[model samples]
Target chain A: MTKHKIRKLPLFTLIFFLLLFMAGVISGEPSRVLEQSRQICLSCIGIG
Target chain B: MELARKWVQIVIGFLTNGYWAFPFTRTIYQGPLKVVCSPGLNCYSCPASTTYCPIGAIQQLIAGIRFNLGLGQYYLGWYVLGCIGVVGGFLGRMVCGWACPFGFVQEIIHKIPGPKFKIPRILRYVKYIILSVMVILLPLLAVNEFDMGDPWFCKYVCPAGTLEAGLPMLVIQPDLRAAIGHLFFNKLAILIFFVVWSIMASRPFCRVACPLGAFYALFSRVRLVRLRLNREKCTDCGACHQVCPMGVKFNESPNDAECITCMACMERACKYGAISLEVGGLPLHSSPLRKTTKS
Candidate 1:
């Protein structure tokens, strides 16, 4: 991928995960929500 | 401009992963040290973690079941090996540059005004020694009643634990405060020392202390994401060296283990687009067939 594409990939992924994370938080399953949140945290860390 | 950059860094750092906050607290209510990546050399025992730290996990594994090598072994092996092979392979020390929450903490602290003292050249090896002794040798050699060794770094050092786990818990739980003893005091002192050091140095822990940083440094030369230099187009202006916080002379070796892939020099000094990230000596931007030769 081009540099612009590579950079945009992370941005898009971040937005997608953020939306999923918010949905998980609102879904009312605390354990699953927490797991999703942890995944988002890992994504933010960018190592996973 | 410098102050603006510092403020931007501080704000971004704080918003991204400040441990001393309520959102972090809410996240930790689910589990401690459960975050996939241990930002700094913080121990897993730090209450702020959402996942287990690899170092802490390895130590705990070694301490728990003397060479039985069952579940603990599998878990530790997977995490460490996966981190090295996958994360280290892909990003190299970019994790240190951008992602690590603890690194962000140190960056913020380093912004404070002070005469930063460089650790003596001889003392640079101290972290490797710490890793060999505290991380590897102790757990492998020593045995207690439960066939476990101590988490020496976590117990004795690791400021990340002090700031992220210890202080918060101590504030919240009065009994923990009463139980505080010499061990807590010692860790606190180490934390203070590093905190002070950070104000002067770019990343003292990553430079001289972090075993994980050491691990990543090993792969930096051949990692999938690495700095490339086009020698032909390059005037040896030395701007890259000047911009590097880690004191790397990028022209000598863009793949220097000390280079954290922070892109500061790449952004600032490469007037000719001479420096770029590459895999297998090919710039990531170029077509596979072109295989443009470096200057």
Candidate 2:
């Protein structure tokens, strides 16, 4: 890779890292998901 | 690189759905870790899933909005959507090729001895329809008298939920046996159909049915992590196209919606080093830098 192209790596890496951090901070805990999943969701199971 | 990708797919699958010890437990993992979304098509209802399925979570939020639309009791699943958007915006469908368990299952099935088939190009749009209708619109608009909406995608579709969660639950919970009805049979039928089809075609679900894949494909043109082709270096030899399991015509469109970024096309397929896995134009995986000497 040329030096000009090589310089672009850090920008992409930074964006990727920031996206991960943002996703972690934005999402809520699993309790809600667990509650939904634990039940035999009528819709998901095709009973609805 | 193919073997390495398969290993990554398997490892990520196991890690994302890692409650293997309690494989019979229909109850999802309620730990703090479950708050995070793994970038794949893993079902949250899977007995072994530690992280929540973003797609399922989004559907639930949409369904719940019917009763609480104006009552200030509704949340729009901003977090879940954000998780999906961030990942999709960066990696596109690379997750499908290297991380999704369902995709891995399809890949393995295609290896079975069978006459392969090619899906028509027009059929690729079906997944986008599934994403918009079954996943989004149906959940929001199909409320009943109780103001409850069905997760239409998961209910009538989603073989992942069926194979990972429904089948296991039926086996372990004796009481659930009585509840086995036509609906269960229908879901089983869908799963069987996909499984058999995968044996004869590559990633039929990903290409034609996966809402999550459709969502990610939207970002293919602008994703930070993607396959880049140096047009000047390309000879139109079609070697890269030959190895592409998704049948992406990289010569015409390197960042097409159908490109999965599996790197099969990048790993020595281009004799001129035209194709490479790049992070914003910087080559991450490609042929080694050519040796140059000062004149």
Docking verdict class for candidate 2: acceptable
lDDT of 2 at B93: 94
Listed in order, each prediction's TM-score against the native is 0.71, 0.88
lDDT of candidate 1 over B61-97, digit per residue (tens):
4454464444333222333334344556666676677
- List DockQ for all candidates: 0.04, 0.28
- lDDT string for model 2 (B1-295, tens) is 8889888998999899888766444455656667778799888767788777878887887887767566655356665776777787668899899889999999988999989888788989999999899889998999999787878888889998899878876666656777777887899899999999999889999999999999889878767788888876777878787888888888888879998888887774666777778776567776443343212
Best by DockQ: 2
CA lDDT for candidate 2: 0.77
Candidate 1: residue B246 lDDT (0-100): 73
For residue A25, model 2's alpha carbon misses the true position, in angstroms, by: 6.6
TM-scores (chain A) of the candidates: 0.46, 0.44
